[model samples]
Target chain A: MNEALLAELRAALTPARVRTGATELGLYRRDASNIEGSAGVVCFPRTTEEVQACVRACVRHEVPFVPRGSGTGLAGGATPLDHAVVIALTKMDRVLSVDAVNRSAWVEPGVLNLDLTRQVAHLGLHFAPDPSSQQSCSIGGNVANNSGGPHCLADGVTTSHILAAEVVLTDGSVVVLGSEAWETHGLDLRGAFVGSEGMFGIATKLCVRLTQNAPAVTTMLMDFESVDAGAHTVSAIIADGMVPAALEMMDQLCIQAVEAYIHAGLPTDAAAVLLVEVAGLPHGVAADAARIVEIGTAHGARSVRIAQDEAERALLWKGRKTAFGAIARIKPNYYLHDTVVPRRALPDVLRQVYEVVERHDLLVLNVFHAGDGNLHPLLVFDKREPGVMARVHAAGEEIVRISVEAGGVLSGEHGIGLEKRDYMPLMFAPADLAAQAAVRRAFDPTGLANPSKVLPSPAGCGDLQHVPEGAWV
Target chain B: MIDLLAFAAEVGDAEPVTITGLGTRGGAVPDVRVVRAPAGIDWVQADEMTVCCGAGTPVDELVTELAAYRQTVALPAGGTVGGALAVGRADARQLGWGPVRDALLQARYVSAAGEVVKAGGPTVKNVSGFDVCRLLVGSHGTLGFIGEVILRTRPLARHSQWFHRADVHDPSDVFTTLYRPVSVLWNGSAVWVLLEGHPDDVAEQAAVASLVACEGPPALPTGSRRLVPPAQVPLLTGGFVAELGVGVVHHAEASDAAVRPERAQVLDHTVRQALDPSGRLNPGR
Candidate 1:
């Protein structure tokens, strides 16, 4: 933890690679969640050996270290809570190998989300797990959060896309978790590592599944008179035995904010908007689009629009993808939270969420992946206003409660970062949390990797961050 | 009882008992207890698309069903809804589909007492886990057990298709596309392009596949397997292609597909996870 030790670490990497200044340390202290802390020193390790060396140095010095990727995470997952060393992996970006015929990629975790696709474009293969921030987020962050995006409705979350990973455990021991060669000889330690929210160790390299680009694609944007109708449309489509690539829903508040910010021409008059996308054979694509139009009209769609070309598709998606930034532009501050439920219960959950937000006297912008039941309900607030941040937190907590009550979970993709750490008990029992914690302990016994995040403090065991409905029931 | 966890014997035909690997999936279970084999169970073939394992095995230890293949149970999402015929929970179209079961071609296991049994050889579809050998597929622990499972491997599909158009001025366009597909019986979810066949056939399809927002015709990040027709070119391509001209597809998406010790264990574990409180096998712990 001293400068001499830090200097020794700096000698391992380029001197310019290590950052120890106040401004740089401040920047590395938190992720998008804005949690505050300080790191003794931050080093960008470019190779697995350097990472091992950093871990050995930390072990030798008895200092804790946190491995960081792109800081686009909402959970403060990459935030440094203690005076630990931050081993950032952005410099290690490399697409090591692509087995085109096999449909998989071996990459260093620092590789950007979209870079893998760029590298594999020639082989008729592409990595499928895409978070909205794919352009900026690192694959490491995606692996840590088990991030899910719109396409996940059909493809699945990050855990599904990760076939194998090479991790550097906290003890400076370089042990491979999953196998690229196929089949581990013993217990599947890989399943427990994903979505551990950086509590286990650093994912240095990943073997991820890349998908074939569909031959044809069709995107649609539709407006409904009510969010309920929009929600029902998603279930109706699925029940009809059709699974679209992506089905996203946004309420009027979200639409208005996004439209105002981007001039993307989102319909402000409708109560909600559903963005639906389908892909396949040319005939199948056209047929599916026609059926969706039929369903929308029957369900009382106010209006619907289809993108005519790639430009139109970009325009249509701009609003949905940059929605967070757009809303942030409108409001000085906002609390973003994610929850997921079974697709069938979306209507009830959305309705309850609206009522709860109203009760708290807060503004809510609802944006969600409708097909998979992953909801990102943003509570807009100005932190400068006293008690507003706390109010937004409470309302946000309520929305997660509603999701859990409806047979959902506290997180679909954002992960149980520092923001939702206190709320972990709302979704899991003490024993269940302990089981997850045990998995973390097995991977990182020292508790040095991004500590004090997902689970609540032991002292506040009885504090209710999320209210279960039965508290009154 | 055959110590199903033991690993030191290779039984000949004259050996009266049957040697079973983890019981196969599909159809009914034969009535017989099993002896265990330990170190004798090992993965013999490890490649990009397929992995072959010894019968007395655990699927959970097989590659963690990672990436695009871990969504629902290979037999639909709810639970072990179907009988324990599906080993890997492979195909989305059919729960407990045929391909994963068919992958178990080579097997060597011991019988109730101490007889080694063998079925299906080392080929992709060695015709081993068939009616005679398949009776041990899902019998909990009854019948001949498994000593090995030879998997049929495949390459991941390269392309997925989303047919909706983008860049529209009016909202009606969205409505038209969303509803038009539903009106007709068109499956609107992303189109999957798992293809296998001659290079000319693949080239023909690739030539027609549009390049608007398409991502690849290149190598993938790792290894993948697909269920493709032998004669048709897949719209998308992947890495490490392997083709076995069989009529089976594995449901790699199932949570239990990569973890089932045996098809029979699927039922017992799920029921145990749901019904058993206090981790007790006996009633009213």
Candidate 2:
């Protein structure tokens, strides 16, 4: 980074808050993805005003800036490319205010996702979007990715839960998208901004709508003799007119990995397992659970187990959420893909996914949200292996292609960051992509918020961001 | 179903056009040409829980067809699907149905550049690109002429019925006490709660809340609806029917401040201009 820009960043944010050391900058380079980027300098913004100051300085210096939260994103959305200024928002963590009567809360961008639910537990309300990494992922990151969790099957995704956001645009001006009031006017700019991959602006504060706790809950685990049976049960459950709070599936590979790690009593002998949870009134929950179990049994489920208490429910969810971590038992590294296909096309898509993995000579685990058909196929391998990444990339691309061919999308929750930027053309036409570019241009006319992120490279959206002289990708 | 690409050509051939369906809300507008979708009930993916229809499809007709499959989209049935979207109609069941915009999953519309563009996709949850479908909703057709839309559909509740509680001061309390109410409407005097769920669950909630079964939902008087803060619903003097938790009030009289979220005029103008550079889609609606 140039000394002059460093001085300006240091002056705006105290010298202690702005760090340009190689060791510290290395930590800010990449998120959880395999891709890595170099950061020009990093600045810690404690407030929205501080965020605005950082944006203003970046704008004046004509340098691009990336807003980073917990750095838990897997799609590389927070990867600072071309030595962009990294404005870390971790210090702004705070649940600013809670309106219990209205069942809404205003929180700073840096607050942890699960912590918001913990803070508001006493009010009998919780934030709805609970991505598996909710424990460490920041709500700002969730907002940027438009994250979805297991509960999002019934509760909807981050976009549905987020009521409004106070954003600092690329030009250093602040604007509020969406409205706190239910009746909004003009355009749904907030909806457009939610999953922009931080290319539009930075959300300083977010007003998230909290969902009321159901009167009753039940979590059940059903083991099937085959992946076909498990997928069949998922279709039957939804076809029966009851959307379970969550319906998750784990193939034999995932079951073995999870059982080895958590020992949550997952049936390793079964070919597949379905974790179905329902929440509502006591009678409704009971009815829904009974119907789901009946559907599972009819679909060739071998055995069914219901969580006896809250502890057991947590145990079942722990097994599901930690499925990714358990992949280390089979391989040292994994490349996960998020794609959604039609519910009925699950079997075909999985068959193709397995075929692709087998052809590429890689190990993959199928554990994903079955209710919504969002497949998270983990390609497990050792990165140290010679030419393993090439095979992983090939299989990953094929899975996405198959999913999109089955009337699916490029991404369901994990957004299209650097990983899927080039694949956007597969799903969208040149005109469709141009409209998206128009949206980004509407927010950041100079294309300097977080360039080369969502829209593919040849979208004709020019960027004025000054790439450093020697920064390499 | 309407061929949206050819429809875009039609829209492009006739520049500066006005498009609407039924012309119910504000009557017809004189223009170069008026257009409508030539399709209705294009497809209903019951397994995927999504329904696609043309812009000219009648909302009630689409609802009836979806109901046969035990599924329904959260769209108001008073007008055509496109008209309801262009006018951004709010449903009485919004308290539980969620925002109207959330129901739209994918939309195909004609852009200002005289081409067909698709936003979002067939899936219920997608983050591939910008949510231009959402921006098209409630836009009053200034941005583009919507051709067809695919909406996320939910199961039709089994036992949905309305009950009324009289002499209610603050509807927010009742809103907090109920469990997954379909809708809660307050017409200045009585609070009507529409509970939809299993028969036993709805009955128990109704008994617990001490509500009396009413014939139907509260009716809104002849006027435009205003969106007040949920907390401010109780402070309204009178002459308004408020959706308790949803923060929409149907005032008996239309006031000047009637839910026009044009506070940030510059940003709104910039976003509008981004998609409609020629400013010819639905000029000066």
Candidate 3:
């Protein structure tokens, strides 16, 4: 970074807001994905205006920069590139207002995901997208990834919950997409920006839609003798026209890991377990829960259990919430892959996933939002092992191929960051990729805002280079 | 049927092209060559939970086909799929079923450069690209000429009708308190609730809602409908139906300019520049 440019950036905002120390810049270099890169400096903007000023300075200096939220993104989306400045948005945290009557909240980009729900809990409203890292992830990060959670099957993802946003473009201009109004007549620009993975611009403020708390709830756990049966039960539940608040599945490996870590009373010996929750009117919820249990049993569930109360329900969810963390006990490192297929194809896709795991001789766990067919296959391996990383990458690529071949997508919730950028071609053709690139070019014509993320660069051939012929078969 | 590829090629690098459907919304732009999808291109393919159809397919025809499967697309009653998707309007039921964007699973369109581009896929959930399928929705042909679309459909409610005569203003409370309703419409003088689902669930919810409103079920009204936000309801003087929970108001008297989302103009222009660099498709509108 040029010293003159640094001085200009310091002049644009408060001098205290800009930091060049190695210690400060080091912290902003990497996110949860651990894809580290050198950064020019770290800017902690406390307000949207301050953010605009920093963006203007970066633009004036022709500097590439990355906007970062809580650094909890699993896709290395927040990992700064070499010669890029890190715009850390943690200081912008604030809930501007909450409209209890309208059931909406105006919040700054840095507001913690769970904090929004906490702020509205008094009014019996809550933000629905509960990504496992809700405790630490920022709303802006959720918007960047279009993050989904267990309840997303019923509630939809971040894009669905978001009503509007005030964003700072790369050119230092601010644009508001969407509005407090339920129907915006113009183009759905907000929808396009939600999952762009920071390539479009940085969102300074967001107006998020809130959902009312369901009056009644039921949570149940069903153990199956085979993972295929669990997948079949998920299809049956959806086919029955029942949309559970949450429907999750955990294979034996995931159950064992969670049990060893938290002792959530999961049946480790079972091939898989389904955690289903229904919420609505008391009578309706009871009816849905009964129907789900009946379907699970008919589909070869060995045992079925319902949470006795709220405490038991909370206990049931604890294991799923912490399943990712528990995988650390199984291996020092794990690459979590997010893919989605049609509900009917879930059985075949899972079978293909296990086949890949067996081929790679790796311990992979299946824990995912099964109701919507979003699978998170955690491939556990030691990074220090010589050939293990290569095999894991190969297996991950194979899984993505299977997913796309089965008429699914490259990603379900986690945005395609550096990790999956190459695999995008497996699901999209060149024309599709070019059209997406055109949208990016329009947003950041200079290609300076979070460059080299989401869409693959034009020069590189995609993941097909690594896969062998008929490998998917 | 007009050859979309040939039309796109003819208009290649053209300064302006007025894309038209049935022109139900208004008149054509002056001093510009008009291009429209030819008749008989309408086609519909319905599966268990989704429908794929030609963009020129009439919304009523699509609705009728989905109704046969006991499923329905959550769009308005009249207009072509291309028009409804291009305008991207949501009806009263958006409170339960999401907006028009939510139903859209995939779309294929011809770009200003005459190249065919497709976004999204034929599935309920996909995060593959930049969500261009949704970006095209409500774009009003400024982006591209939508040729085909795949929409997620929902099972039709076993029982559905408007139950009126309940007096309530600002029914946001009902939305926050009760189970999600298919549609909650409020006229100037009375509230009209549309309940759909299993007979028992609908009856129980409607009974509870009526109890909360302290009124009896009234007669239903018949007429044309338009959808707007709840906040804009009080501004209207005449009788109009408002979807309370979803915050969509249906009034034929509603002004299109009033709901135009002017705040997003800059971003919309930027997107238009990218998708339609030649500025030929629906040049001014």
Better of 2 and 3 by DockQ: 2
Can you write out model 1's per-residue Cα lDDT over A171-258, one digit (the tens) per residue? 6766666454232322334544667777777888998877767777889899998988898888767655466789899999999989
lDDT of model 3, residue A408? 84
Residue-level lDDT of model 3, residues B1-285, one tens digit each, is: 234576456556656877667676543567888766533333333322667777767888888887776678888767787888888777666777778888788877778877767888766656666889878888888888877777877766555655654456655545544566666666666666666555667677767766333343333233434444445554555655666645555555534445444435766777788777768788788
Q: Interface root mean square deviation for model 2, in Å?
A: 1.5
Quality class of the docking in candidate 1, CAPRI style: incorrect
Best by DockQ: 2
The positional error of residue B280 in candidate 2, measured at the CA in angstroms, is 0.6
Choose 2 or 3, whichever is better by lDDT.
2
Task: Kindly report which residue stretches of model 3 are placed more than 4 angstroms away from their true locations once superposed.
Answer: A461-473, B1-48, B158-161, B169-176, B211-240, B245-256, B259-263
Clashing pairs in 2: none
Q: Residue A15 deviation, candidate 2, in Å?
A: 1.0
Query: In candidate 1, what are the lDDT values of residues B1-285, reduced to their tens digit?
Result: 224334424432222323233434332323422233342223322221224444433443443441233211222222221122223333322211222233343344433333454433333211101112222333232333344444433322222332222332222223222211111001121222332222333334434432122332222222233333222212223222222111122222322324423422332332223322222211111
- Residue A29 lDDT (model 2): 92
Ranked by lDDT, the better of candidates 1 and 3 is 3
RMSD over all Cα atoms, model 1: 14.7
Chain B TM-score against the true chain B, candidate 1: 0.36
What's model 3's lDDT at A365? 95
Root-mean-square deviation (CA) per prediction: 14.7, 2.8, 4.0
